[model samples]
Target: MEWTQILTLAAKEFRDRMRNRWVLAVALVFTVFSLVIAYFGGAQQGAVGFRSIEFTIASLVSLVIYLIPLIALLLGFDAIVGERERGSLDLLLSLPITRLELLLGKYLGLAAALTLSTLAGFGLVALLLWQRIDTAGLYHYAGFMLSSVLLGLAFLSLAVLVSVVARDRTRASGLAIALWFFFVLVFDLLLLGVLVGTGGRFGGEAFAWLLLLSPADVFRLLNVFSLDDVRTLYGLASIVPTSLGSPGVMGGVMLAWIALPLVVARWRFK
Candidate 1:
C-alpha cells in the first residue's frame, strides 16, 4: 500500500468528520457528563465533591461502557454502506486507491476522530482535577482514557465490518444496534444465567476465558484490575482470576477485538 495515498484518504475522512461537527458534539457530551459525575455523582450519599481518582474512575467506567460502544457503532455503521447508498462507493472505487488502502484509511481516520473526542472530553476533566489528584491518581485516570479509546476503536471496527456486509445503510444500522446490545447488555447476563442455571457447575475454567469474547468486558477488566479500590468497587476481583487480569493480557485481547473485525471487513469489502 502507498503511504501517501493512504494518509491522504485518512486525512480526507478525518476532515469530513470534523466538518460534520461529530467531534465537537461528542466532546461536549463527554465533558458535560464527566463533570456531572465527578462533582455530584455521590450526591445521594451526601458526598458531593471531587472524590478520589479511583472512585471517579469507577463511576466513569459504567458510563463509558454503555456510552462509548453505542457512540462508536453509530459513528462507523455507515462508513461503507452510506457511501454505497449515496452512489459514491463505485465512484471512489474507480479512483486510483485499492480496497485495502481505502478500508485501512477509513478505519484509521475514524479511530483518530474517536480518540481525539475521548481525550478532549476526558482530558478537560483531568485538567480540572489535576491539582486535587496525585501522580498515581493521574496515571490511573490516564489509563482509563487510553483504555476507553481502545474500547471505542474495537466497536468501531465491528461497525466497519457490518457496513461492509450489509446491503444498505438501514440494515447496517440495525446490525450495529444489535451488536451494541449483544456486547454491552446481553453477553454478561447470558453468561451469568448459564452459570446460575447450571449451579456454577458448567463453564468452569472456560467461562473466565469467555469474557474475552466481549470487548466491553475486556475493557472493564483492564480498568477494574488496575487499582485496588476500583477493583473492590467493581467486585470482580475473585471472578476475573489474577492470571487473566494482567494489563498486558487484557490489552492484547482488546487489540484482537479491534483486529479480527477489521480483517473480516477487509475481506468482505474486497
Candidate 2:
C-alpha cells in the first residue's frame, strides 16, 4: 500500500540484478541475435544483407516468442522462494513493508530490468537500421518492441505466481519451465492437433479465440496483424477474426495476462 516501501524494495531488487550483470548479459544476447537476424537472415538463401523491415520484424517475432518467456521465467521464478530459502522473507516482512508492497516491488523491479534489457538490446538494432527503414517501418518496429516487453511482463507475472505457490525453489523452477514449455511450445501444437483430429469441424471462431488464451499467441497476433505483408506471410488472415485482431483488443488481453497472475499470487501470498 505504501509507495515508499514498494519503491525501496524495487530499487534494491533492481540494484541486485544490475550488480550481477544479468541485465547486460540479456541485452547483449538480444543485440547479437537481432543483428545477426537483421543482416544475415538471408544467408541460407544465398543472399546476405539487411532485409526489409517487415521481414526482419517477422523473424524477430519468432525469436522474441521463444527467448523472452524463458528469460523472464528464469529471472523471477525464484523471486519470493529464493528469499524464503535464504530466510530473508520473514525478516523483510518484519520490516515496515506489507505483503502487497513486497509483491508489487519484486514484480516492478524485475519488470523494469527486463524492459530495459529488451529495449536496449532491440533498440540498438533499431538504431542500426534507422537509415534503411522509413517512418512507417520505424513505427511498426517500435510496436514490436513494446509488445515484446508486454510478453516478458506477462511471463514474469506467471513466474511470480509460481514462486508464491510452490513449496520450494526447485518446485517453483520446475513449474516455471513447464509453463515456458506449455505456452511457448506445446500450446499451439495441441490446438492444431485438435483442429486436425476433428477435421476442421470443431474450430472456427472458437479456434481463433483459443489463441488469445496464450500470451505468446496473443503477442504473435498483435505483431502479425499490424503488418499486412507479415500477416499474409503467416497466413493468419483467415484464422484470426477482425474483432480479435485489433491492436487495442490484443493489448488489453496482454495486460490481463500480466495482471491476473499477480492478483492470484497476491491472494496466495497472503
Candidate 3:
C-alpha cells in the first residue's frame, strides 16, 4: 500500500469524523462520566480511610473496558456500508483509490478517532486521581487503563471489519452491534452459566483456554490479575484460576482477534 494514498485517505476520514458531532458529543459525555465516577468512588471508598484512589481507578477501568468497546462499535458500525447506503461508496470507490488503500485509510482514520476519545476519558480519570489523594499502585492503575484503551482499539477494528463486509448501513450496524453485545454482554453471561453449572469449579488448562476465547474475560483478567494480592485477600471471583499465561498472552489474544476479523473483511471486500 502506498503511504501517500493511505495517509491522504486517513486525513480525509479524520476530518469527516471530527466534523461529525456524534463523535465529539460521545467523547464529551464519556469524559464527564469518568470524572464523576472517579470522584465519587474515591470520596466514598477512601473516606473510610481506605485508599479511595485505587478503588476509584479500578471501578473506572471496568467501566472503560465495557463502554469504550461499545463506543468503538457505535462510531464505526457504518464506516463503509453507511457510505453505500447514502449512495456514496460506489462513487468513492470509483475514484483512483484501490480497495486496499481505502481499507487501510479508513481503519487508521477511524481507529485514531476512537483512540483520541478513549485517551480523553483516561486522561480525565488520571488527572482526577492524581490531584485528589495518594494512591499506592499508580503504575498498575495506569497499566490497567492503557491495556483497556488498546483493548478498545481491538473492538473498533472488529466493527470496521464488520462495516466493510456488510452490504448496507442498517445490516452492518445491526451485525456490529450484535457482535458487541455477544462478546461483551452475552459472552459473560455464558461464562457465568458454565461456572455455575460446574459448581464454579475450575479443573485445568481448558478453563483457561475457554476464558481466553472471550475478549471481555481477557480484559477482566488483565484488570484483576494485576491485583493478585487483592484477589487472594478479597476473594472476589478468584476461585477459578484466571491465572492466564501472563499479561502478554492475553494481549496477544486481543490483538489476534483485532487482526483476524480485518483480514477476513478485506478478503470479503475484495
Q: Top TM-score: which candidate number? A: 2
Point to the candidate with the largest lDDT: 2
| Error in Å for residue 146 of model 1 | 0.4
Candidate 2, backbone clash total: 0
Clashes of 1: 0
Worst 10 residues of 1 by lDDT: 200-209
CA lDDT of every candidate: 0.93, 0.95, 0.73
Query: Where does the lowest 10-residue lDDT sum fall in candidate 2?
Result: 198-207
Q: Give me the displacement of residue 121 in model 2, in angstroms.
A: 0.3
The better-scoring model by TM-score among 1 and 2 is 2
Report the C-alpha lDDT of model 2 over 1-270, residue by residue, as the tens digit: 899989888999899999999999999999999999988888888989997999999999999999999999999999999999999999999998889999999999999999999999999999988999999999999999999999999999999999999989999999999999999999999999989999988875599999999999999999999999999989998878888889999999999999999999999999
Per residue, candidate 1 scores C-alpha lDDT tens digits across 92-125 of 8999989999888888899999999999999999
Off by over 4 Å in 2: none
In candidate 2 the C-alpha lDDT for residue 209 amounts to: 92
Model 3, 1-270: lDDT tens digits are 688988988888788888976557766867787777755655654543235555655666567767878888887878778777889878878988888888888888887777777667666656655755556566776777677767777888888888988887788888877987898789867867877788767433356567677677777776666765544433445444554636777778888877887888788778
